[model samples]
Target: MKPKKKSLSDLGGIMYSTDPSFVYEEENEIPEQALPNQQQDLRVMLDKKNRGGKAVTLVTGFRGSDEALEKLGKMLKTKCGVGGAAKDGEVMIQGDFRDKVVDLLQKEGFKVKKSGG
Candidate 1:
């Protein structure tokens, strides 16, 4: 029987392998089923709360990332020339822009859902 290969520790206790095909580590890959849950996407919703008597459109269902909401808020504010804010994974635009916002978000390939009274 042949002797087993021994690994060597280089400087500062770093390990090295003579084999070129050896990989020390691999990336953390997420499962396919968890992809949707882990997706950094957003879903839009219409909200009607104490919006200072103004009709506010609420965008929600974001997968934990606020980047899209922030960007969308900016775009909507600029496009509609209205004011809006992104908070708690949701964006609130100051107006009843459900139809227009839905169209814009759909055009950008986002699954938007409107909800309100």
Candidate 2:
């Protein structure tokens, strides 16, 4: 494959224009992390659609940073005594721990509901 072109952001520098009116200043600022919405409810369920008949506990409707999601996933995995992965704003636990996860999330101030059988 041919080498792809890089954008200004990929280059990591500010743009400059020949015109005196145009100027670019590089501002390195980290955005404030978003807090999870209390009004919004999270869903926990079991999914086995594409895993060759293996069930995975899925926690969705998480509205926060990936780090926060991973933290929650890690906590759940620890509590359930199992292993899993967290990514793409969703947490996946290796087994069926719907009730356990729901209880845990409720304790953590998350409005969680069991979805799907």
Candidate 3:
């Protein structure tokens, strides 16, 4: 199934250019590189605000590409033996595993800190 175009901006912002010589230039974005594990300052916290009171362990402060983020998330999930998601530069584990997550990250060479209750 084809996806729907949400706005005029999706058409490259020059939908009605009359000039025959006009050419659409697509913007190329470069993904940010992942930092070394030792340089990563990650925070592990327990969050329960929007999940119907079910607490989740959220790891934030990752500065890396989505692929790297997903890989890290997968590793965390596998090691923690829990189901969760990794996206938007954050990794969410299904339950309250802040202490465990912090220890895991620290062992992996990341500077991890436990934040929040």
Q: Which one is best on TM-score?
A: 3
lDDT of each: 0.63, 0.81, 0.87
lDDT per residue, candidate 1, 67-115, as tens digits? 6547767887777778999766567888878888888777766766666
Relative to the true structure, candidate 1 reaches a TM of: 0.57
Least well predicted 10-residue stretch by lDDT in candidate 3: 1-10
Q: TM-scores for all candidates?
A: 0.57, 0.69, 0.74
* Best model number under lDDT: 3
Give stretches of model 2 more than 4 Å off. 1-33
lDDT of 2: 0.81
Each model's backbone clash number: 0, 0, 0
- Per-residue lDDT for 1-117 in model 2, tens only? 112238877545655567888655545656445566565478999999999999999998887666777888899999999999988768999989899999999988889999998
lDDT (C-alpha) at residue 6 in model 3: 82
Q: Which stretches of candidate 3 lie over 4 Å from their true place?
A: 1-30
Better of 1 and 2 by lDDT: 2
Kindly list the per-residue Cα lDDT of model 3 for residues 50-117, writing each as its tens digit. Answer: 89999899999898877888999999999999999998788999998888898889988999988886
